[model samples]
Target chain A: MKVVLHIWRQSRPSTSQDFGQDGKMVRYELDDVSADMSFLEMLDILNERLTAKGEEPVAFDHDCREGICGTCSLMINGRPHGPERGTTACQLHMRSFQDGSEIWIEPWRAKSFPVLRDLVVDRGAFDRVVQAGAFISVNTGAAVDANAMPVPKADADKAFDAATCIGCGACVAACKNASAMLFAGAKVSHFLHLPQGQAERDRRVLNLVETMDKEGFGNCTNQYECEAACPKEIPVRVIADMNREYNRARIKS
Target chain B: MNWMLDYWRSSIGGKVTMAITGLLLFGFLVGHLAGNLLLLSGPEAMNEYAAFLKSKGALLWVVRCGLLAVFVLHVITGIRLARENRNARPIAYARPDTIQASLASRSMVFTGLSTLVFVVYHLLHFTVGVTNPEHFTMETSAGGHNVYGMVTASFSVVGIALAYVAFQVVLFFHLAHGVQSLAHTLGLHHERFTPMIKTASVGVAALITGGNIFLVLSVLLGIVEVQS
Candidate 1:
């Protein structure tokens, strides 16, 4: 299959960059490219070719390639992860494209996640947000039995849905406003759903939203672009949940 | 002021106001698009439509005033809500890297302000006949009725035409956020309909912006010449 790859290449984060300027559209013609090969694996072949030619390999981050890790992020053409719903970049297959298709691959362009080298971004901001307490503060001395807590099925389902966030940062990349409310809301709602987390529910929403704001993430304009771009399909309802929780906390304070 | 704050915070009044005003703007966009579509019929059609608007006298003024009130209320309530959200988190997050969001969502306030400026300029240039010099060319038709000649004349100027295009682009961004937010404010942001709303809003904004840009560019390029 012949594929014209328009890949974004950057030497360093400090260097001024443009889509196809600092980045070049490298063309590749290959035979017997498997449809089942993951997008990263396909990239592996491209990198191999570059390495053989004594050229710098295209630098993209992928750890697991199993879609569990959110590292393999790319804006394929105008859509994220090649227009597949509920899937990461690593899970996207070559079958999604025709043989003669022109693929435009670029790193996530958000102010918060500045490019470190090439496709690799400093996603440490997500880690810092989580460290700000995206969990219940519970002691391990007396572990409560699962049956003892007795969470309702509905609340548990909601919590599980919130917990499904893989911290990919795709929501931020997709949103026109660059708002992290969906991500922050997911984190806040995950904890707010259970009795164990109820103790810190108010504090959690307040702290997380404050943290999100301080980190320079934009406010949710309810455009739901985050949800649309989300690989996990996280609902914007979680944002409303966060808003409700924040309002409650404000009153209590 | 305290009462105002309470009203803004206590009930769903703030949310309802945001939704209602947003929907009004939405309605205005439809009317504006309809009015602007007269451009496709050539300058005479557009001008005649504009003159008709002027002849409405007090009724036109009443509609303008109503639109002004809606716009003011929407912007004010939106600002207040954003401020309240900000105040909810006075302290900075200790860990800043845990969440990854977008620039559009982050710079909404800035984009919104730019759009506001564009809106005022738009009204002054076209509606109030205060900004664009060409807008003064409007005159009565042979039937002793005032007809719209100013709009086509205004579009003839390269600077005004370019400004209109730029402002329309800003308007697209504003609508992209505003329309979807309106749905959320009204509690209609279910998963099934949310995407439809977002896509529809973007499409509508694109159409409006594209149509206006095309009209201005056609006029500026002499593709569509205005009548004497």
Candidate 2:
């Protein structure tokens, strides 16, 4: 298959404009590429070609190309990880592309996630939000019995769902306001649903949410863009639960 | 508690304030609509009702002040949130195909601002009696202050009636998104009942806007009489 990649090229955030002056979409046409290649593998092929020509290889982030690491981030065309739902960019196959088609590939577009180079962004803001207090303070003791705490099936299931978030920042990229509510909400709900996380429930929600806001993420307006764009399919209702916890924290304090 | 002030200053706090204040305003809208519905019952009933409300004196002023505070808070929070949202996305997407956000959700700020403008114009036209002096008279019958005459006369003007109807349309957009968003902001949503909540939001918005528009049009159509 022949694919023409119209990819965004930015030098770096330090010397380049964040609002469009220094960025340009450079096109590279690759012929006889295998349709069986993963999107990341296709990018690798392009990088190989660019390196053979002694041109600088297009830089993109990809740690675990299997999609668990959440490092393979790309806004293919206009979507967070291309048009397919429940799939990250690394999992997206080249078979989805039509022959001789032009695919627009760009980095996550948000003020908070600044472009580091071509198709890569610094997503440390998410790490900072989690660092605020999305965890439980459990004393390091002997491993407790696995079935010690009687957990409801519903709650356990919800906690697992909330726990599936990979910190991909796709929700922020998909949101019109670049809100991080989905990510923050998932972190809050994950802990709020567990008995192990019950001690500092209110503090967890408040601090994490406050940190998210301090990091310049936008407020959730119930747009559902985050949910739709989430590769894990985490619901936006988690955000509502986050609100409930934050309000409860305020009232109780 | 300063905790509240601090919470209210956060992102989620702004949203919570908007949710709570919007619901308060929604209550006021329903009550005001019910009171205006009395106009269809003729001048004696409407005037008596208006007098009853006015007779509360101190209680009425307290309620008015509280309502004003709620209204102002809702507006200020909404404006601040909208501004922050705009700032979050400094670089616009070249091709953003919004699959999830409704047109109403995105246009909330515009609708809310339009409604705010209409509220000011409304206070001036009817409450302050400054927009149309001839129409807004204080000298009608019934021991009360001619409330029924004032309402009918102001709504009878074609231009005023059209403007009211237009604002009513904007109010519909505001309430439709505002009500459903309250569910999320207040943490009252469930996956099983989301569609139902959205439907009810639209239904409530329509009832309020349609009911008020019906009253304005009835006066314009001469379906109701302006008691002398």
Point to the candidate with the largest DockQ: 2
Error of 1 at B179 (Å): 5.8
List TM-score per model, in order.
Answer: 0.62, 0.93
Residue pairs with backbone overlap in model 2: none
Where in model 2 is the C-alpha error above 4 Å?
A: A1-4, A14-21, A27-35, A97-102, A139-143, B142-144, B226-228
- Ten-residue segment with the worst summed lDDT in candidate 1 chain A? A14-23
Q: Could you report the Cα RMSD, in angstroms, for every candidate shown?
A: 9.7, 2.4
lDDT of 2 by residue, A174-211 (tens): 99889999999999889888899898888888789878
Estimate, for each residue in B1-228, the C-alpha lDDT of model 2 and write its tens digit.
787778788998999899999999999999999999999999888888988988999999999999999999999999899889988877776656787788889899999999888899899988888887776675554345788888888888789899999999989988999999998799987878988999999999999999999999999999999543
Q: Indicate the residue-level lDDT of A170 in model 2.
A: 95
Candidates in order have lDDT scores of: 0.71, 0.88
**DockQ, each predicted model:** 0.08, 0.68
Error of 2 at B129 (Å): 1.4
What's model 1's TM-score?
0.62
